[model samples]
Target: MEPGTHDLRVLIGRQRLCDVLFEGLGAFMLLMSLFILAALFINLAIEGLARLQPDFFLDFPSRRAGQAGILSAWVGSVLVMLVTAAAALPVGVAAGIWLEEYAPKNWLTDVVEINVTNLAGVPSIIYGLLALGLLVHQFRLGESILTAGLTLGMMILPVVIVSTREAIRAVPQTIREAAYGLGASRWRVTRDHVLPYSVAGILTGVIIGLSRAIGETAPIITIGALTFIAFLPPAPVSAVPPFINFEWLSSPFTVLPIQMFNWISRPDPAFQSNAAAAGLVLVILTLFMNAMAIWLRYRARKRIKW
Candidate 1:
């Protein structure tokens, strides 16, 4: 062979080796992820299985520990999760849409972009501190469900915004141009064409953000969420003469992570078991959110015409 051709063959052989090595590394990481997931499921099941009695779901936390169920924590978690989603979704989606579609490429937008990226990396504990300062101290909101929800909403805001932007950006430019060509206004193009196409991605991001918010304990704790609550939260609206009340905003609530933390801190062996059970519940909740997001994405892909 010519000398030039021989050198080229040698370089090509080296490149092929590097590619094979990278592929193997990728496969190894995937297998490791699966193994870790399986191990976690096994460990959680073993710890929580014997404690998964029906009463575990129905009963409230007890001093006896063994008799304690996760009722209050479960309800509180659900309420907080719902409230946080309510507060975060609209704001996050709007901010995302504006940044991705409407915001001019200026220094202000660049600054906003940088701040959002920085916010995503900020610790949950830092958000808790912010909530403490802003909600509890400044606003005098006290330790309440609304305060906790708002704090979590802020904590997850960056995630939701970034996810939403990515989702909107994923929609093909051709569709938007087509809508505009058909005499649609920018708002109409976004609302009728782009938004519908990106709904699944947005929902997936929302669900993932919610999962993170629900599992977080630090911000709520900083905002003075109680470790224990004996009573159910009052309804946000009442059927009585006045009809509406924000009294639910004033009541104490116990989230699952807070309850789990409290349980794990107890010296009793039974509390450890309860903590394990709570952890199992939390894992299940996260998994359910992820599964729903996956299903939504799958359906969205199936519905796409091209």
Candidate 2:
């Protein structure tokens, strides 16, 4: 063999060896992440499995740790999430659509974009403090579910807005042009063609934002949500002619994260087990939200070809 050919072969062999080493390193990193998650879940299951009774879902927290359940905590979480979604979704989607579709390419628009991107990176604790001043103190909403929900909505708004813009931008420009060629109004084109195709991506963002909001402790705590809440919110139905009651929005509330935090802070072993069980429940709830997002994305992909 020629000397040049042998040197080239040697170089090629060295490159292949480096590639294999990098691949092995990547695999090792992934496995390490999975191992950590598995170990955490296993520990939680062992501590909480015995406490997973029907009453665990039905009863409210009590002075006795054994008798305490997550009824009020979970219910509060659901109500607060509903309010957060209501406050965040329409505004985020609208802001995203306008910015992507209508905003002129100007310095003002660039500034708005920069601020929103910056907001997404801001710490959750800062959001909490902001809410403490704006919603709780200035607005006098007090320490209530509504206050907590609105605080969280503000915290997650950037996530939704950025996600919505990305989803809308992902739609091919050809689709919009074709619709315009067909004499469709811009709104009609956006409503019928662009949004339909991008629903999956938008929903994925919303679900991820909601999952984070549901697990948050700082904003809610800063807004003065209690660690222990035993009473349920007022029924949605009322005997009065108005029929629907919304007074519960002003009621005191506690969510699973706050409850778990409370339990985990206790000195007793039983409370530690309670905290583990609550943590497990919160994880299950977050997972369920993500699964629904995945299912929605799958359905959207099947229904829309583009």
Candidate 3:
């Protein structure tokens, strides 16, 4: 063989060696990370398993650590999350579609997109401050469920928007071209073809953003969410005509993270246990949301033909 051929073979061999070394290093890092996660979870379960009773979900928080429960906290978390989802879903999805599909390719849209992308990485506290000024004071929404929901919704809005744009962008250009060729209106094509193909991705992003929001303590606390609340919001259903109550939107609230924070901040060991239990629950919830996202993506990929 010629010298050039020999040199080429030596370069290929060196590249494979580098690949093997990196592969081993990556595997080691992965295993070490998993080991740390498992250890932390095991410790939490050991500390809190006995305290994680059914009553933990049913009873109101109390002065006595053993008697205290997360009834109001969990309820508020669910309601706030519901409002967050409701507030963010349509607006984020719509903004994403318009930007990606119809926005004029000009300086203004470019600047808007840049700001949105940058907003996604801004600290949660900045959003909290903004919400406190705009939602709490300027708008007089107060420190209520609606305020908290909208605050968290706005915090995650950029994430949803960015994810949605990416998902829509992922739809093959051929699909959009074919639809246009067949005389489908832009709205119709987006509604029928692009949306269906991208729904899974959009949902995964939304859920992941929600999971991040659910654990946030700063924004909620900054917005004046109560750390301890013994009462539930008014029933969302009423016996009166029209049957649905809107008053709950303005009701004061708490959440699992705040409850955990309250418990952990106390000096009592029993309160520590309670905090551990709440932490366990919070972790489980975050994990479940993430798992749902993974499942949605997997199912969508499996169902897609091309």
Better of 1 and 2 by lDDT: 2
lDDT of 1 by residue, 63-145 (tens): 98879988888888888887799999999999999899899989999998998999999999998999899888999988888
lDDT for each of the candidates?
0.87, 0.89, 0.91
Cα displacement (angstroms), candidate 3, residue 38, comes to 1.0
Weakest lDDT window of 10 consecutive positions for candidate 1: 222-231
For 176-265, candidate 2 gives per-residue lDDT tens digits of 999999999989998999887787888888998999999999878877775568899997678887999899999889998999998988
RMSD after CA superposition, every candidate: 3.6, 2.3, 3.5
Q: What is the lDDT of residue 168 in candidate 3?
A: 93
CA lDDT for candidate 2: 0.89
Between candidates 1 and 2, which one is better according to TM-score?
A: 2
Give the Å error, residue 253, model 1. 0.6
Task: Point out where model 1 deviates above 4 Å.
Answer: 1-30, 237-244
**Per-model TM-score versus the true fold:** 0.88, 0.92, 0.91
